[model samples]
Target: MKITFLGTGTGIPQDGRVQSGVLLDTGKNLLLFDCGCGVLGRIHESGYEHKDIDAIIITHLHLDHVGDILALIKANWLLGKTDMRIYGPQGTKEWFEKTLDVYDYLRDRFTVEITELSPEEEFIPQGTEGNCNCNIRSAKTAHTDNSLAYRIESSHKTVVYTGDTEPCQEVMELAEDADVLIHECSFPLGFPMTNHTTPDLLTLMMDEYPLTAKKLYLTHLYPQMQGRYREATDHIRKYYKGEVIIAKDLMVVEIQDD
Candidate 1:
């Protein structure tokens, strides 16, 4: 599986970064996670055809995460590819409906299948041709009321993507023993925050609960993390022995052997 960080920034704007979005190329199909603002352009910039996305899995409904979802769906429709299956936490169906309700021209232009998922539930997306190439699971996260952390496993490797979360045991357990944990380190060290992560808060989770992944890639950065990349990694390394990387836009990771 190839994971691409299409947009690594948060709601705040910054140079060389957009909002939250990532792509997992399963080789069979492309699984898109969190299509936030600027993700559509980033998808094009990343050399990925927007129409090739088979499914979109959302972690939450925050604007920073779901901002570009409508634009993407409309883009696919323009490309004559309208069939899409989207899976997400509880308010997903309602959110999509409400979002589309405001756009009179876009509604009924495509066939969208939205599935509402719950913690601990696992399933393959409906449109996979044969046996699903990967197993996808979700766990409750400490962000919004319906936020989720996802665990995706191909035959060879497992990866966890934490959308936007604070240091929480449920997300930690969801990431246990995965090859890479793509977590949100939204702030820099010593930045007092809530419902988001900082290097200090993440390491606190590391020291207490322990992230067992071989590598940890931090994304969903706020402007606060602008020049603190090295310092953040240094702080995390004090508790986590694995490689700690600050993810950038368009950075790619192959899960099978990374």
Candidate 2:
């Protein structure tokens, strides 16, 4: 499995970082997680064709996470690739309908299959049916009422993406034994924040449940995280024994089966 960090920034803009987006290529299918602002361009910058994305799995309806959903669909529509599969938490279908209501011109231009998923629900994304090499499971996150974290297992490798959340048990359990945990670290080590992650808060949770993921890639950075990457990794290393990495935009990581 190959993972690409398309956009690693947050709602706040920063140099060299866009918003929240990650692309996972399972060799059989390409899945996009969290298509936030600037992700469309980042896709091209990363040498990927936006229209080739098989499915988009969203975490929440926050603007920073869903900002580019319509844009991507529209871009594909313009390129004559109209079919899109979008899966997300409750209110996903309603949110798309409401958003499309304003842009009526683009409403009927293409076909979009939107599935509203619940916590703990597992399913294979559309268009990857026959192979069925990839399976995705969702878990409720601590950030919003319907926000979700996803666990994707394929080719004997597992990757967990914590969209946007504080230190929580539901996500930790979902990510247990994953090969890669792409978690959000929105703030610095000692920054006081809620509904987002800090190095201190993450380590506090790790001290209790103990994340056994082989690799931990910190993402969803805010400007405050600038120059604090080493400190955050060092702090988490003291509590966790896995390889800690700070994800950067367009960076790629590949996991192979043993």
Best by lDDT: 2
Q: List clashing residue pairs in candidate 2.
A: none
Question: Could you tell me the C-alpha RMSD of candidate 1 in Å?
Answer: 1.3
Give lDDT tens digits, candidate 2, residues 1-258: 999999999999999999999999998788999999999999999998998889999999999999999999999999999899999999999999999998999967999999999999999898634434699999999999999999999988999999999989999999999999999999998798999999999999988889999999999999989989999999999999999999999999999777
Task: List residue ranges in candidate 1 displaced over 4 A.
Answer: 128-131
TM-score, one value per model: 0.97, 0.98
Worst 10 residues of 1 by lDDT: 124-133
Local accuracy of candidate 1 as per-residue lDDT tens digits, 69-176 = 989989888989878889999999999888888998887799898999999999987553544588999999989998999999986788899999998999889888
Q: Pick the candidate with the highest TM-score.
A: 2
lDDT of 1 at 165: 93
Looking at model 2, residue 231 earns an lDDT score of 97
